[model samples]
Target: MSVVLAGGGSAGHVTPLLALADCLRRRDPATRITVLGTAEGLEARLVPARGYELVQLPKVPMPRRPGPDLLRIGGRLREAVRAAGAALDAAEADVVVGFGGYVCPPAYLAARRRGTPIVIHEANPLPGLANRLGARLTPYVATTFPHTPLPHAVQTGVPLRHEISDLARADDAERLARRLLAREHFGLDLDRTTVLVTGGSLGAQRLNDTFGEAAPDLRAAGAQVLHVSGTGKQVEVRQSAGGAGDDVPPYVVVPYVDAMEQAYAAADLVVCRAGANTVCELATVGLPAAYVPLPVGNGEQRLNAEPVVAAGGGLLVDDADCTAGWVREVLVPLLQDAAALRAMGEAAARFVVPDADERLADLVEAAVEGRRVPS
Candidate 1:
């Protein structure tokens, strides 16, 4: 089977596309997979590294207001569609799968014009413009969260890397062993309750500042913090924590966590932004979190964490209130309660759909065969 997967702009869009590609390869090593992206998107780097053919198109963002760019939008979109059409034809694509980003709409339109099957996977509870458009073209729509107001949307969960999925779905003994191993590998205290603080690749300034201020309190409560302050942002956090100590400090400040699975394993609780992928991964691994939604855009980040938080798996703190005071009053007490933590973790695990990648792959195969399910 020949498949063309589309998405890009951020890791949220690209990661799932790679996961789907991995699933397609595992299902049939001979299946040809091509990824559609733009030169500006992260997929330009990530897709090629994953060993998939990447077709680059011009980035065409939807303008929110009237401007000179509005006139140029039509020309740019047409160019992107034409490029995508050529890529699809060249790949002999049986199905075009989109994860919903800047590149998806043109890819969807191109595939639709060619009468090729289109499958869309929406990672957020709030559907983006591209996936919403794709959903109108086909009933084969999959979503990470339930009730994501889109046409024929099925709750298939988010496609995660095999390593993460397997670890998340592991049995009691295996999961425990892996977690222990991860802590040892990271040189983290096995006895201490570990809290992971991350704000994403470039990092969130608010998270870094607030967490740095709260680090001492976190340590006083017998909890160790692993704060990933993004690239080049760790120095400020270290300075805030009284510079780098000779001994293993209660709070470890790192620029980035390249091996995120290890960080996840070493963490008993998480404090981070509520990106779609982050919420899904946390739920999958049964980790409780204090999610601070990014205070920007269409408020989609808050929407992403709503279900998990509602299900008693996590807490949603508004961006404005995610300060040191809030952490001292709420987070510290929560960490102190071991029973509550376990219960929340159980709730998170139960809320997750373990086999989303395989299930979505089945949907892709069906689409390739011209068999369209009602959702």
Candidate 2:
């Protein structure tokens, strides 16, 4: 049997697809998993590395702003759907699952025309524009959040790295993570609080710029900061730190963190955005974070962060209020109060669903096996 895994344009979307692929392979090794994505997406490298056949399409995002550019995006959407239909014909896929991103438009619409069972995993608390538009094309809707707005929602939580999953299951998530990879790889101080600052793989400009000004204070607190600066911002971020320490200052900055499992494990606190999949992973790992939802359309990141914050597992800082002083103000006391930090960590642990991968695999299995079974 063949399964089509569709989602990308960013690392956040690809991570879950990788997770589900791992689960599906174990359940049914004979399964041939094909990844359908755009040529310009991050999937170009990610999919092939995972040993899956990649079906590339042509598409671009519906830009955040309004104007005539919307017309171009609409044209691409139509062309992408047609491209996906062609791929489906070539692959003879039995089922197609969309993990959400710009890739959803083609995967969902094409699969619908082929009468292939369609499944969508909405990985944001507030659905993205692509996901909200794609939901109507599929009856099988799965969610990373427990109470997302999608219809017929099955709470699947988030699929994590294979190593992270194994570590989390061994009852020594922190220790296993430490041994499996060294924080020193990123030049982080093992004795000090290691706060990871990242805005997904492409990097968040606002996050990088904001964290830049706070580096001095963070270093003075005896904290080590590992900032993942996407693209050309590495020099600026490093310069922003102002030589906060000696021995490379243990203030590391990288363009992209290829080994993300170590990053999460080494982090005592996280300063980042809250995308649906990442939030689930953070909760699973029981790490407290100060989240600044990207101040973009619909405040989607805030929506994603709400449940965890409400549960006392994390803090939410609006973008307008997120500044260097604000970062130190929230984190300084939290880091100083070890007991409160531990409590918040424990709160985060409460949100994890241990059997999420298996459960999601079962749902996919049922769809591929057939819908109308004898009672």
lDDT of 2 by residue, 34-94 (tens): 8988788888888888888898888667554456875767777888889888888888999
- Residue-level error in angstroms, candidate 1, position 286: 0.4
lDDT tens per residue, model 1, 136-215: 99978998888889888888999988778878868989877887897777667777899999997768889999988887
Candidate 1 residue pairs that clash: none
Residue 198, candidate 1: C-alpha displacement in angstroms: 1.1
- Relative to the unseen true structure, what is the C-alpha lDDT of residue 255 in candidate 1, on a scale of 0 to 100? 82
Q: RMSD per prediction, one decimal? A: 2.3, 3.3
TM-score of each: 0.93, 0.89
TM-score of 2: 0.89
Total clashes in model 1, counting residue pairs 3 or more apart in sequence or in different chains? 0
lDDT score at residue 120, model 2, on the 0-100 scale? 77
